[model samples]
Target chain A: MRVSKFDRPYESGRPERHQLRVENISLSFGGVRALTDVSLTCEPGEILAIIGPNGAGKTSMLNCICGLYHPQKGRIMYGNHNLARTSSHHLPKMGIARTFQNIELFRHMTVLNNLMLGRHVHMKKNILTALLYWGWAEREEIENRRFVEHVIDLLEIQHIRKQMVGSLAYGLQKRVELGRALAMNPGLILLDEPMAGMNVEEKEDMARFILDINEEWGITTILIEHDMGVVMDISDRVAVLEFGRLIGIGTPDEVRENPDVIRAYLGQDHGGRS
Target chain B: MMATTQCGVFHESYRSDMQLRPTTWQRLRVVVVFAFIIILPFVASAQNLRIANTVVIAAIGAIGLNILVGYTGQISLGQGAFLAVGAYSTGLLMHYYELPWPIALVLGALITAMFGAVFGIPSLRLKGLYLAVATLAAQQIVGWFVRNWDPIDGTKADGAARELSMPRALFFGDKLNDSEFAFYVVGMIALVIVAVVATNLFRTHIGRAFVAIRDQDIAAEVMGVNVFQYKLVAFATSSFFVGLAGGLTAVHSTNISFERFTIDVSIEYLAMIIIGGLGSISGSIYGAAFVKLLPEILRDVGLWIADQGWLASGQLDQYLPFAEDAAFGLAIILTLIFEPEGIVKLWSDLKAYFRLWPFSY
Candidate 1:
């Protein structure tokens, strides 16, 4: 459902979104190579899922794109800005948003506050105005609150909007995490394990929300998720990782049949190599 | 999921939901509180009014401490030093420059904020106990400067005197001299302005940013909060309120001394916020009053015990003075033991209990 609000002031005259491009990035800590010359490109509005076995550097690759990790080599570009060089703090303003593998919510605050914080980059603030809470701050807050409410509606979290996020159930927390990333109104979203440790039903719910967020907002999604069935069903393109190396990068069907992907990652259920 | 803050009450709009006080009971409570404050001077004695003024002034400082320590999750031990900076700046502006007290207070708060921001520099690189120690240096350094600096030693030329005194301020046209009732207007105004400003601050993005920085700095940073800048802003905002308290204190007594704003004084303000509630604005007021009043009440209790022949009168006199210090220690211990989240949790629990009052469900 389209959000009914027409007075989204900042949504007007928006610049065209830039495609995310990662060119041969490598990352290491001390002596351990977390990612080795990993390179991939995400078009402006496609969901690219990175599938890998445990310890296959999926999170690390997502981290590099979000500026949480600076690559030792290769250029990570989103639009014109180099993700490797730009401060992680600046990424949100540039319309880059992400959720964590382990939820990093402001635990003390309510769900409403957490979601409002997601709009921090877009909210205009002047300390004097904020001190009085009179004009610009109030206007920005109401406008943003209206926008965030639509996200709440989208995620079906209207019931728990006032609940403290820290006290919520795990599946609920994951949904709230996604809602927070969506609250950024980002052009590009990198979800690091958006659905992990959930019942099949909750997984389906999260998957549907992912699809909705991408299709409704036209947000370019770079998702790192396990659960191959869900990933293959939802993603437009799939990249396979093994031992810090990209073995295959193509459509879900293309990667499914690739001999290296099956042998390295997809062959876990079978006793023999593909 | 269908529950409401009040069983029958529900918000119809986001604007109503965003309100600081949305309920009829809360609005009435505010009006009742203002009425009580308005009637207080008439019923209270001059000495009682003086203490009330002191309590409110302490409330201002405690609120300041809460902003940094509780809300922002930035620990501060320099509360006393920041207060001294404020007190001294207010005193200096009044004595040397002949500025009016209100202007002096405003300027003093600004000056104190600068000091707060500068001392808060180490916080960007350090936190917790390390930040506490770094801020402790502010208390020491400012104390030393007050004692040693010839110029800061009030209006005395002998250089032996450490206390500074200022003439009484004229409020609107009348002199606020000698009467606690008159001086109370200044304290009340400062408290109201501060409490409102502080409460308003948290409802907006700036206040939320402080909380975000405190709760999850990395997430906040990635989510586009300038963590370093917000941290400094927290320091400055907290110090500004502390300074206002100091300025009020200056106006209340029309004098200042190093002993008055000592390390113990700093610890007392810290104790106020801790005992009141970290990050709770009202808890600051409650804490300041609790910290200030409990000791005096204990002293009275000590005297009453002596009067009632429960203890030897002369024998108790020697230790009667220690009752205040003893009360401080006891209050902290009891608060930690009974309500670790401080009085704020107790208040919330009380509200929750009443929310389902018909049964203990």
Candidate 2:
């Protein structure tokens, strides 16, 4: 199948020195503060992990970055754009994509169709061409399918490509969610608990994919996980948050030894075990 | 022992995988079915041909409803209203403005689509039963307006509604006879074109977006699908086909009463999609045929019973009409209870069962 011209990656030429700088981003729901005064920076092609106990505002911060939840104060600067103003629907077109903490896949759709939707922003066929679907529409469809097949290959999900997402096992469903995000060919990908309820083997495979996505694909990544072993093994940098407050941000080793991070985890009886 | 058992057809590419009929056997089956349909008019009587025309028209409307409710997960009870709009608009344009029927048909579809989009706006804030009730209001509003509006003297003195009669269908200045006009122009040819267009639609990004929204709307949003815009497009496109079906119906029957586009017609269209299979183009056609033929079958059975002299003819005839309605309702209930995936799934299961014949596994 021929890949459509639109399915090609966005050529910004050489990858620019992209950086996502979140400065003092504060978020709240009425009286309940979810994230307060959280600041972090992710450099180009680096895998940054955000780690915290439950309700430590890790997902909230990712939501703020993805434009799903606008902060009450501060700014999220991705290169030149202010992400706080960007609508979640427009984020994908602007080269930002994310997965959900709970797998948010189109459950009734086949895995192929779900991943093909990741290329929605790149598809340019209008209704007229779609109805006439033999010429331009078919070409574009084949092209998009080629890109989706690449994602399926990368995620090693070729066996269940035609299976419905709802019928798949939980581990495979998480991988499909990752494939769906990668199908967007995003410059900056946010992964919210991508390896949440997986076995040790599944967690290792997910970590390897994340590392490959960041290094080989030259895509920046923000991963949120409760598994400290996976986080420390793959992440280039780590940021710690405690009850809506940023407690530490540094290289994985530095953040691991930080006293405030230890107090926060130990105080809540979260042993930060593997 | 046959160690080298044949698997099904291999789809080497997404292109092949997406093909409507990928296997040789599937292609052969389709060809045989189409050949049967093409030769049906030659063998069947005029009355049976008329029933076939009704089936095709109903299929178009059913496909439209399936797109909204089945693929897009937006329940709409306003198909009857949209059909009325299409029929009335086409009728008025052809009669008063002396427009060509083809142009009038397109304009009628466009008008009904606009109406459908307006009704779909409420869907942004409502869903499920709430949205269903909101669309039901469209039927009432359109029905009331058509009955009372006197600009075209819509209401007759005897309390019967005015009929919208279509002009003789002109194709390159030649008048087509009733069967040619109805079956060729408005039935088979129209169905083929609509079916092809619909199949092509499901293969594209827009169609995938509709399915995504149906499955998980919040997920669809994060993936860059404009949920509100796509919802409106779904409504508009569904109404477009239903409106075209409405125009074709007027042309086929030569005259249409406002009473024809009632709530009962809306329910029948919904039942067609549900009983046939939701979110499937071929399923829509099967559903239409089943629903449309049920009444005819009941009538034939009634006549046979009366001829046997087992019962009084007048008494049997009186109850036979009610039996048709009861049978229709029972079919819907039974289908939902036994096979919620509908007849298409059931048929596929049977095919699979036979394919693995002589091997219980």
Candidate 3:
């Protein structure tokens, strides 16, 4: 099989020329290989979706990219920096932000406060200044609040900004989680199932928001989602994973026509490519 | 134009636009409390004032424990250890070295904060039951070491043991033998600590991170909070205050012993936080006062009952034996069962009901 023309241009930017590069990564937990030789490339201003079945290490791959779990083998390169050696706390400042599979919003904090936490890395004022809330600290606080208000407006969650996150509806809570990640204003945003348990209309809305975030903000997005239709619609390129290995990587149409991807999804031989 | 601007200004001054504090009722309450504290020594008996001083000292300890256990959700049974460190540090400095009172107090807090950080390192790595055991072990080890150390007891004989002694006072080159003066000092320190704690908490990122880690550690980590660093900071801050309270306690009393800073004292502080309400500044003070004064009240009742002619004094000793301990245990169990949120919740609800009396649904 030959690489398609549309896929070739995307491949030129592979691993080396991109903002985040995951090369031949493998991770094992207690004798169980969670990820094996999974390689993916994410560039600036692109939506790269990773589609696979459950336990295919989609989230584990994201964890490795964000420096949560150091892969047993392989390297993660982020803009001339080796992610393997970088601390987890430094990842956010390095322009990498991620959300969880289960919504991990700070339930007790107000929606505004939760978003404010995302800006913790950027807030420069120290403890003494913050205690006084005068001089540079007050200015910093106002600037951060203005940025957070912009995020709240962009997500259309202004009405519930003061309300506790735990009291919001599930769909609204998911939106607030995205707002929190957006507050970081990262170069690459990792979304772990952004529209997991939503209705069709909600999924469509989230897909539009994801596309808007990529096109308008020029932020690269690496999304792990199971809904192929939503992934196919929003993603410029998609990677298919089966048993922690990359089975297909191409444009949506080429991946749709791949024989291995078809087998991985349908669990049987399909005459799409062969 | 003037009329329109006046109307806009009037609208801006609506009831909902009012500030959070210094309400009419709150102002009156503050005035009353200040007056009560000022006049209390004159009206209350000396024994009663002594008990009040104990409550104030316990309040200081409870506030410190609240920072560790209430806001940060770290299980710490070594608060009593920090207290002992502070008391002994102050005692040694004032008695042996003849340091000034203010300098001794500062040194006591600093030494305790350093010790707290050492214990906090393991606490950051281990949590829940393991953390509890670690702090409990600290309490035991520190208590035993201080009790057995010959220099601390000021005994010249190699094996002789005695209770440690604290200097009466550090100011004016004179001792503070009066109970009233001790009461005033403890009360002033307690008031200042509560104010500072109330102001600093929730104002800085450290405070918010402590609360965030308490609610969800994983989420806090994902949000770029250094959980280990914040946990250690919580321990250091909490223990420093505990040490300050210990120093005040040593000054408040004539003598100190290992028994005063035992695991039981730690449990008593825990009970104060639990019965007062977790995560509330006012709750710590309330719990401390209730736990400290309840026994004395019960003892008075027991004495009155013994004199009621229904029971002879000799028989009363047998029947109502250990009345103080029994009351403390009963109060803890009853508070847990009926008002798990603690006395703070009850106070809040009462105030809320009054505020929204006619409109409450």
lDDT of 3 by residue, B31-54 (tens): 897788878877888788778788
User: Which ranges in model 1 have alpha carbons more than 4 Å from their true place?
Assistant: A1-15, A266-274, B1-4, B154-161, B172-177
lDDT of 2 at A10: 36
Docking class of 2: medium
Q: Chain A structural similarity (TM-score) per candidate?
A: 0.92, 0.92, 0.90
- Stretches > 4 Å off in candidate 3: A1-18, A124-140, A270-274, B1-35, B155-161, B170-177, B314-321, B359-361
Q: At residue B359, what lDDT does model 1 achieve? A: 84
Looking at model 1, the pairs that clash are B70-B279
How far out, in Å, is residue B142 in model 1? 1.2
State TM-scores per candidate. Answer: 0.94, 0.93, 0.88
Q: Model 2, range B138-236, lDDT digits (tens) per residue?
A: 999999887766644443574567766667776655442365534554468778888889888988999999999898888898899999899999999
lDDT of 2: 0.85
- lDDT, model 3, position B121: 91
Q: Is the docking of candidate 1 incorrect, acceptable, medium or high quality?
A: medium
Which candidate comes out best when scored by lDDT?
1
Q: Write model 1 residue lDDT over A1-274, tens digit each, in one string.
A: 2456343433542335788888999999999999999888899989999989999999989888888889899999887889988778899988888999999999888899999999988787788999988677788898888778888888899889888888899999999888888888888888989888999999989999999878777788989888889999999999998989999999999998999997895355555554
Pairs of colliding residues, candidate 2: A3-A143, A4-A143
lDDT of 1 at B230: 89
Residue B248 lDDT, candidate 2, scale 0-100: 78
